[model samples]
Structures are given as C-alpha cells and as structure tokens.
Target: MLSIEGLRVEVEGKEILKGLDLEVNAGEVHAIMGPNGSGKSTLAHVLAGREGYQISGGKLRYLGLDLQELEIEERAHAGIFLAMQYPVELPGVNNMIFLREALNAIRRARGEPEIDALGFMKQVRDKARELNLDEKLLKRSVNAGFSGGEKKRNEVLQMAMLAPKLAILDETDSGLDIDALRIVADGVNLLRSPERALILVTHYQRLLDYIQPDRVHVLAAGRIVRSGGRELALELEEKGYGWLSEEAAA
Candidate 1:
C-alpha cells in the first residue's frame, strides 16, 4: 500500500535518509530493526509528512497517489497513521474528545457524515475495551498522568479506532514492561488484515517475539542495508548490528 523508492531526506542541510528504499504491501507486517541514529524515526516522520525535512530526492507513493502532493493531514485522511514513540500529554483535552474530533475530521475530509456524541463515545469505549483500557482513562486528559504502557496502549486504541490502511509504529514498545508490551502487541496483532499493513520500527527483538513480522529489515547508514525473514531479528539479537554494518558496507 506504500512504496518509498530511493528516498533521500535532509534536515537543515544534513542528510538522514540516503537512497532508502522500502515497500510495504497490504496485509504484511515489516519490522525495521536498527541501532541508534540509523534513520528509523526519520523514515516514520517522512512517511507521516512531518515538516522540517526536505525530500531532496525520492518518490513517496501511497494508495496510487503521489504522497508529496498531500499535506500532513491530507496524508492522514488518505489512511496513513503514525503511532509516535512519545505520545504527547494534553492538559485540557480528554482522550474521548481528542479521538472523536480526530475521527470526525478524517471523516469530514473524506466527505463522510460526522458521528454524534453518543455514537462516538460508544465506539471509543468499545475500542478502549478491545485494548483493555480502563473506561475512566477515556475521561482523563490525553496521556496525562498515564504510565508509559498506558500511553502505548492508548496509541493502539487510536489505531484501532481510526482503522487506518497503513500504520507506522515508531518504537511503540519503548519503556514498556513485559505485560504492557504483550498488551500493545496483542492490540497491534488484532488489527492485522488483508486490507491493512504495519511498519514496526524498533531497536530490539523482544517485540518481534509477540508480533512476528513477515519480513525483517536492517536499517543502518541511512538505508535498509539487509533484509531477511523473522530469523533476521534473532540473528541481530545474537550477533549484533556490527556484523550487519560490515555487510552493508561490503
């Protein structure tokens, strides 16, 4: 559903992605494993159309349209979702209100009718339950006073509610304990389907144990250097990225 070819991105004259190539088809989960500063987050931001990065060279095509032609919200309206590594805390905005507005905004963008208050509440609560989130948490300010795991689950809850065609998760497993990791993974697994695809960017292999990817990619030196199956994550865990860096250079 998403194709990125020869992507070269620069932020303030410094290049982060150099000829990075990746394609995520519908119904497939691809895990991008890389060490620090390997451009994993940069890739996610570029896909989401975040500002400040210039696409010096490349083509980003999503759902058959040139992604460069769409704005950030336009990309969201086009069914691209990014679950951030750090979910922001909104002081006055409740989670329920946040989600309803977001959902309706996308709907309006797509020329669909808005959901009423009652309908919106029910759907959010149901989705929250699906992610095992407490009903009261919905009433609280978005991510305010939430634990790390709760924040991650809330991200999943948003993904579940939005039901995007492509979801890019940038380190959703970061700072979560085992139980929370499993919960987040479970929520992600439930969303897998022939109509959807996921790009999971992570630094470790433990998350892969719960959510097995169809393909594994090693990102280093601003590009996807090597790719393999699920076993690739295991090998990276055993041998580390030093070997892959050598392979990539070779």
Candidate 2:
C-alpha cells in the first residue's frame, strides 16, 4: 500500500533519515526495530506528514498517490493513521466529542455522510470494547489524568475505530505493564486484515513476541541496515542492537 525509495529527511542542519527505503503491502505487519536515535520515530513522523522534516530526496507513493504532496489532514483523510509515541492531552475536551468530530471530519473530506450521534457512539463503544478500554474514559477529557497504559490503550482504540489503510504505530508498547501490553497487542492483532497494513516502530522485542510481525527491519543511522523475518526480532533480543550498529557502520 506504500512505497518509498531513497528517502532522505533532514531536521535543522543535520539529516536523520539518509537514503532510507521501505515498502509496505496490504495485510502485512512490519516492525521497525532500532536503538535510541536510530530514526524510528522520525520515519513515523515523516510518513504522517508532520512538519519540520524536509524531504530532500526520494519518492514516497501511497496507493499510487504522490504522498509528499498531501497535507497532514489530507493524509488522515486518505486513510493514513499515526499512533503517536506520546498521545497528547486535550484538556477541556470530551474524549468522545473529540473523536467523533475527528472521525466525521475525515468522513466529510471523503464525501461520505457524517454518522449520527447514536451511530457514532455505537462505533466508538464497539472499538473501545475491542481495546478493552473503559466506556467512562470516553466521557472524560482526552488523555487528561490518564495513566501511561490508558493513553496507549486510547491510541489503539482510535486505530480500531479509524481502520486506516496504513497504520503507523510509533512505540505504542512503550511504558506498559505486561497485562496492558497484551491487551494492546490483542487489539492490534484483531485489526489485521487482507486490505490493511501496519507499521510498528519500536525498540524492544517484547512487543514482537505478542504481535508476531511478518517482517522485522533494523534501522540504524537513519537507514534500514538489515531486514529479516520474525526470527530476526528474537535474534536482536538475544544479541542486542550493538552488534547491528557495528555491522551497519562497517
């Protein structure tokens, strides 16, 4: 569903993604594993059309569209979702209200009719149940006073509701206990379909143990240094990223 070639991104005066290339197809889950500062989050941000990162060179085509030409909202409307590393707190905003508006806005952009209030609530409730999120949290302010696990669960709930064609989850498993991690992973796994694709950007192999990604790519110094199957995550867990970084530098 997505294709990238020789993608280079620069922040400030330095480059973070250097000649990176990646392709994701429908129905496949790809895990991006890397050490700190290896540009995993950068890739997520760039794919979501976040500002400040200059694409100096490369071709990024999403479903045959010129991805770089689309704005952030356009990307979302076009079925691209990014589950942030740190979900933002929208104080004074009702969680359900905020999500409904966002979902309706995307629907509007796509020339679809807005769902009625009752229908929207049913949708949200269904997705929340899928993620094992409490219905009470939907009535509260978005991410306000939420625990770390709550925030991540909220992200997965959004993913389930949105059902994006390409979902980029940046460190969604970070800061979660084992139980919370399992819940989130189960929610993600349930969403896997032949028409959808997922990109999981993470640091540890623990998350992979639950998600069982179809492919694993080790990113270092802004490039995918190695690509392998699910066993690669196990190898990385056993040997650590230090060995991969050395191999990349060599």
Candidate 3:
C-alpha cells in the first residue's frame, strides 16, 4: 500500500531521514521503533505531506502513485490517514461536526454519497463507545480540555471513522496508560483488514504487545538498520536500542 525508497528528507537545512527505505503492503502491520532524533516522526510527517519538510532525495509512492505529487488534502482523500503524536485542539469546533464534515469530504472525493446526519451520528456513537470515548466529548470542541489519553483515543476514533487504506500512527501510545493503551490498541486492531495497512511509529515495545506487527523495524540514524519479526521487538525491549544504534554506526 505504501512504498518508500532511499527516502532522504530535510527540515530547514539539516537532513533528517537519510536513505530510509520501507515497503508496507496491504494486510501488513509494520512497527517502526527508534530512540530520540532517529527520524521516525520525520518519516511519518513526510508521508503525511506536512509542510516545512524538504524531500532532498529518494522516492515515495502510495498505491502506485507518486506520493510527493499529491497535496496534503489529496493524500487524505486518497485514503492516507496520519494519527498525529499530538492531536491539535480546535476551539469552537464541535468534534462531531468536524468529524462528519471530514468524513463526508473524503466520501465525496471518492464519488460516494455523503452520510446523512442520523447515520453519521450512529456511526460516531458506536465508534466512540467502542473506543471508550465519552459521548459528551463529541459535543465539545475537538480535543479541547481532553486529557492526554483522551486525545490519543480521539485520534484512534478519527482513524476508525475514516477507514483509511494506510494508517500512520505516530506514537499513539506515548501518553496513554495501560487501560487507555489497551482501549486504543483494541480499536486499532478492529480496523485491521486485508485491504488496510498500518505503520505504527513508536518509541517502546509495549504498544507492539497489544497490536502485533507483521514486521518490526529498527530505525536509527535516519534509516532502517534492521527488520525482523515480533521477536525483534522483544529483543529491543530486553537489550534496548543501544546495540542497534552501535551496529548501524559500525
């Protein structure tokens, strides 16, 4: 579903992702784990078409189309979803309304009819309940006054509703406690399908324990230095990233 090859990216004048390469096919879950400043988030942001990042080199393609050619909204409309590490707050914007509009916008782009208010509400309520999200929060401004765990759940809620082809979650587990993490992971697991792929960018292996990945990649120094199965995550958890970083350097 997504192809990244020798992807080099720069923010301002400094390079971040240096010759990174990854391939995620449909029906696969890939976990990207790394320490601080390893360009894990940079890869996520670049794939999401966030501004301020310059693609200095390499190629990125999604569903066989050139990803760099698509604008941010276009990428979203094309079924690319990025659950950010920090979900922004929009004061005065009703969470329900924002989600409905966003979902309908994507639907319309795909030549599908917009979901009616009743259907949308039902869908929202069902997903909110599944995510253990307070129904009252849906009536409030998006992410406003939401706790860290609530914000992460809100991100998962959005992903569930959008049903994107490729979902990139950037540290959805960062601030979540065990219960919240399980709730969020369960919601993410429910979205898993043969037609949908997920790239989870995380710092620790705890998240992987809930949502088992088809492959675990260790990204250090802006590139994937090792790719292995779930055991790799266990190894990382036991041995930490120091060995991997040293190996990459060597």
Candidate 4:
C-alpha cells in the first residue's frame, strides 16, 4: 500500500534520511527499530508532509499516488494517519471542538457534508468508549492539563476516528505503564484490517509484545541494516543496538 525508494531527506542543511527504501503492503504491520538520531522520526515527519524537511532525493508512493506531491492535510485526507510522539497542548481549543473541526476538515476534503454537532458528539463518544478513553476528556482542552497517558490515549482516539488506510505510529509506546500500553495497543490492534497497513517506529521490543508485527527492521544511521522476524526484536532487546550498529558498519 506504501512504497518508498531511495528517499534522502535533509533538515537545516543536515541530511537525516539517506537512501531509505521500504515497502509496506496491505494487511501487514512493520516495525522499525532504531537508535536515537537514526532518522526514524524524520521518516514520519517527511511522510506527514511537515515543512523544513528538504527532500534531497527519491520517491514516496502511497497507494499509487505520489506522496511527496501532497500536503499534510492532503495526506491525512488520503487515509494516511500519523500518531505523534509528543501531542501538543492547545489551551484555548476544547478537545471536542478540535476533533470536530479536524473531522469536518477531512470530510470536506473528501466532498462529504459536515456532520451536525449532535452526530459528531455521538461519534466521539463511541470512539472514546472503544479506545477506553473517558468521555470527560472530550470536553477538556486539547492536551491541556492532560497526563502523559491521557495524551497518548487522545492520539489513539484520533486514529480511531480518522480510520486511515495506513497508520504510522511514532513511539506510541513511550512514557506509558504496562496497563496504559495495553490500552493503546488494543486501540491499534482494533484498527488492523486487510485493506490497511501499519508502520510502528519504536526503540524497544516491549510494544511488540502487545501488537505483533509481520516483519521487523533495524534501522541505523538512516538506513535499514537488518531485516528479520519477531525473534530479532528479542535478540536486540537482550544484546542492544550497539551490536547492530557495528554490524551495519561492517
């Protein structure tokens, strides 16, 4: 469903992603494990169409459309979802209002009519219940006064509502207890389908325990160095990324 070829990206005149190539087919989940500064988050930002990341070279195709040609909103409307690692706080925007606006924006982009307030509220309630999120959270400001776990849950709620064809989660398992992680994982697992693909960017293998991936890749220095099955994750957890880096250098 998604294909990238020889993608090289740079930010602030510094190259981050160098000759990165990946392909994710429908009904598959791929995990990208890498150490810090390995361009994992950079790949997510570039795919999301965030500004300031200069595409030095290569191509990104999403379901046959040229991803690099689309804007961030366009990507979102095209059924591409990104769960950010750090969700920003919007003090003035009520969570419900923000979500409604986002949903409407996406709907409008797809030539769909805007949903009424009541209908939107019902959808929010239903999604929140499915994700194990509290209804009160919808009434509060976006990420304002929310705990770390709450922020992560809010991200998952957005994913559930958006129902993207390809979901790219950047460190969704960070800063969460086991219980919170399970809830977040459940939200992701529920979204899996034959027509959808998932790319999980993580540092540890703990999150893999909840949501098993079809393939595991170890990325180092902006490139994939090792591709293996689920067992590779366990080995990395036991031995650490240093060995992988050395292997990549070799």
lDDT of each: 0.94, 0.94, 0.96, 0.93
- Worst window of 10 by summed lDDT in candidate 4: 158-167
Off by over 4 Å in 3: none
RMSD of 1: 0.9
Error of 4 at 236 (Å): 1.1
Q: Judged by TM-score relative to the true structure, which candidate is superior, 3 or 4?
A: 3
lDDT per residue as tens, model 3, 1-250:
7889999999999998999989999999999999999999999999999999999999998999999999999999999999999999999999999999999999999999999999999999999999999999999999999999999999999999999999999999998999999999999999999999999999999999999999999999999999999999999999999999999999
RMSD of 3: 0.6
Tens digits of per-residue lDDT for model 1, 125-170: 8888888898989999999999999999999999998889999999
* Alpha-carbon lDDT of model 1: 0.94
Which stretches of model 4 miss by more than 4 angstroms? none
Tens digits of lDDT, candidate 2, 197-221: 9999999999998998999999999
Q: Which candidate achieves the best TM-score against the true structure?
A: 3
Q: Each candidate's TM vs. the true structure?
A: 0.98, 0.98, 0.99, 0.97
Cα lDDT tens digits for candidate 4, 11-43? 999998889999899999999999999999999
Pairs with steric clashes in candidate 3 = none
| Candidate that beats the other on TM-score, 2 or 3, i.e. the better one | 3
